[model samples]
Target: MARERLEIEAPEVAVHLDAQDPESLRRLVLEACQRASTVRTDHEPLVDLALSQLVRGTPDDNLARKLEELAERTDDRYLTAQEAADPNWATLFRSARLASALSLALREQTRSSVLNSIYEAAHASPDTAAFYRDLLL
Candidate 1:
């Protein structure tokens, strides 16, 4: 079966939940925090150093530093997006690169309606709306 899109509307101004609601907002936060706690940090420092060592470039030190920063950020970006969507690492990574391209336009925080702009730009994406599809779910 095909997976649905990752939806990102202007989240409701207020999504009402009753006191007894099991699916309340607090529950969702608790669940997310718990899941995040399980991802291992044991190899974190070594991974960081190894990754840093492998990411080198540019004629200037500043450019080299900037490139390295980008490399480091892109590393597990796919995995986080996968947390939003599918486990397919390939598709997720493609979406991550796409989102990075989208990130510049995203950085200008004006209204809360970034989703609409993202939706509009989806088609122009390097991966042809893959990240938008990923976000729509």
Candidate 2:
């Protein structure tokens, strides 16, 4: 038997990475965040596809840097567990947002707690609600 290793690359949603300006960077980052939850709706394959699109190619570096600069970053407990094993950077980011949205939506739906903080996001933001609705069921 022989042993082999492989290196994978990210996809290019757009053309050149650095050629993009600030606004484009913002859009890509937000797209990653929004896309972060949107694909979870269709189930696991879609989640994988979403991650493929999310971190595809060198764009993830730009997307991640933009996300860290403009928005909050997510951490994966599962990936953290896997850290001792596989230690995947991209997978960690991919899983975190999905977990965050699922947890938040579940808490909002199941519990009897703060109305404005949780409820407002569900009620006031049509896009947010639609995204979650589209993601969940």
Candidate 3:
């Protein structure tokens, strides 16, 4: 008789949150967002816009519409002309486009949790924490 070998795989670790303490969870999120903002600069402005909109309780549909309008306004011709006229136009346009996309994603509620939705749009994005930090400083 041949002996059979059994293969065992370790389960993936799940992040457990203490739902009872909303305040603590908020603090943790703020801290994480702040840290993430410092490291990730590519979409800082967009992240900031999304967080600010979320904090302000902006309606998803309204936010989406506004973002879409802004994105539409930043057409290829306008961007190309602006880039030609000013060297910083590229950076500004990139940030605008990113912000617009974030607004749409948030409106879609791609993630279940509010924080998760914002973070998914732009990981570790922080505008609220930064605002508080600036105010304190």
TM-score of each: 0.22, 0.27, 0.37
43-129 in candidate 3: lDDT tens per residue? 456567655765554446765666557555654534876958976554445444444544544463322342342232232233533
Ranking by lDDT: 3, 2, 1
Q: lDDT: which candidate is best?
A: 3
Report every candidate's CA lDDT.
0.33, 0.35, 0.42
Q: Which 10 consecutive residues of model 1 have the lowest summed lDDT?
A: 11-20
Top model number, TM-score: 3
Q: Could you give candidate 1's per-residue lDDT for residues 1-137 as a string of tens digits?
A: 53112133322211221122433332332222222222233333432432333222111334334433543464486566667675654443433333322232223322222332233234323443443344333
Query: TM-score: which is higher, 1 or 3?
Result: 3
Residue-level lDDT of model 2, residues 115-135, one tens digit each, is 111222232223443533442
- Tell me the alpha-carbon RMSD of every candidate: 14.2, 17.4, 12.1
Which residue pairs clash within candidate 1? Answer: 5-136, 5-137, 6-135, 6-136, 6-137, 7-136, 7-137
